[model samples]
Target: MPTVTPKTAGPDMSSPKTQILAALRRASWISGQALADAAGISRAAIWKHIHALRREGYTIQASSGRGYRLEHAPDHLSPEGVHAGLQTELLGRNLICRRSIDSTQNLAKSLGRQGAPEGTAVLAENQTQGRGRRGRSWASIPHGVAVSLILRPKTSPDKAPHFPLLAGTALARAVSRVCGIWPGLKWPNDLLISGRKVIGILAELEAEMDRISAIYLGIGLNINAEAEDIPPDLASVATSLRIQAGRKIDRLDLVRALLEELEAAYYAYRLQGFGPIREAWKEHNITLGRQVRISSGREIITGTAVDINEDGALRVRTEEQELVTVSAGDVQLCPAV
Candidate 1:
């Protein structure tokens, strides 16, 4: 991840509630008058905001002389909670968080059509109609991470296929930083730890013949789920950070780290091109140099995974000494016979 200045880091301070929270965080307690002056709001408005924060699960203590003190903050992923200490340039600045939604991708696409700015994000605690590659159903538990990002990049439509690889590399870096365990990238957009799937990425694009309009990148990561939370059909193939680490992980910290890393990757790609991201992806990749089978539509190709090209296509060396580039497919590791 690229390093940013303090000016561009941390939560947006323009929000009155965020400003008050920052003030309170700076000190043990803040006087009502002082908070009002700092927030540029009246004392009554300050009180009202304080009440709203309390309703959102912040334990605030009030006293006649001490004013207001923050006792505790819940672990919820509300907009206010996520913005408390989040550091990013554009991503997560304009965020929409929900307790439950049908799909973050759907909401993100809808927002994109409405001319939502690039770097807008939609997050949900649970997704009822979550989807994966090839229109497969994705199971989303409440403890997992379900978020979609809307991006408008000034690039050609031909480069859109590389977005998933970009997202996967960023996610791998973030998970390694937060979980203390490095995950291997399975070609295209899956992250695996201990040979089990931990994260999946999907990218939907809107484009014309030559120009690209919007890209909605959806990411689902298993953060704090247990073995029992895994669906029966997916039990053998899916795993979570908690199951692997043997301890619960903080979702808010992980989400913040993800946004920051993603922002860095996005800017790097825009300025420096896909060379940096491709190298990073290769460093953590597990598919290359292995024998595999890929199913693209009704055709099946069995070959040795050779490399990924600049356009994010998987290069494979078939048994007949044929080198093929696959742009879309479902991959499976073939057992050596």
Candidate 2:
């Protein structure tokens, strides 16, 4: 039996199991009597929480003499695990961890409306009704990173549209740093590794006139999914960090890194403006200076993506020598002439 470590508890973290895990995290194991005394609960109560933790995919080894040791941590995302080594001030200050949910975005939006604090993170192990852009179904995976964040920025609602682009920039940097694999950014909100999609981001604004009440930023990153786990249609287009890196990445570590990067990027935007974010996005993006086709509603325009403007819109030099700035569209690299 391991005793829970004592740390600053998070909101809604009053459960006995959370405390027990915190204690176990501090060390491999403690005596059963020690755990009971530390948690101020009986040995039977400690055993009950231990059983629940095991059910959630944690491999705890309990012996008559050796007490309990954490042989293996859970593959699934737990708040205790994610927050264990998190390094951030505002971002992920309060985290909502769920075993299964319809969508993190939905819950995040609900929480935002209810005035959830800024930087509150909603994470789910599995999302049954996840969504991408244009109401497309986001494919779910067992060990994927499905998280949504709530941000209340002081900027105008006009800047709301650029949040997704900012997210893409942060995401690429985080992945590159954590997994040691550099990913290229597609226009707006897609991350590709070796020209295959690995992450998708969506940002929605809840605004009142010119003021933005909250921004619900949802991100889905393929971390440890096997090839067979991907859909037939997506096999050629999608990939996971595990598949690319040839090893399973620790989701908790990745999550912490991503949140830190995102927070830094957001703060930079507020303090310095969008110039730094735009520049970073350009450095990692694969769409610029490439022959491209943009599909916006009923019209299709073919051009060369030359630049992204200050407002985060894509600037294209069309085939006819005309310049067009596209604020929203699906961009595709055209076949070389």
lDDT of predicted model 1: 0.87
For this target, which candidate reaches the highest TM-score against the unseen true structure? 1
The parts of candidate 1 lying over 4 Å away from their true place are 1-13, 22-47, 61-71, 335-337
Q: Write the per-residue lDDT of candidate 1 for residues 91-132, one digit (tens) a residue.
A: 988899987889999999999999999989998888999999
Lowest lDDT 10-mer window, candidate 2? 1-10
Candidate 1 global TM-score: 0.90
Error of 2 at 45 (Å): 11
- The Cα RMSD of model 2 versus the native structure comes to 5.5
TM-score, one value per model: 0.90, 0.84
Model 2: CA > 4 A from native: 1-70, 335-337
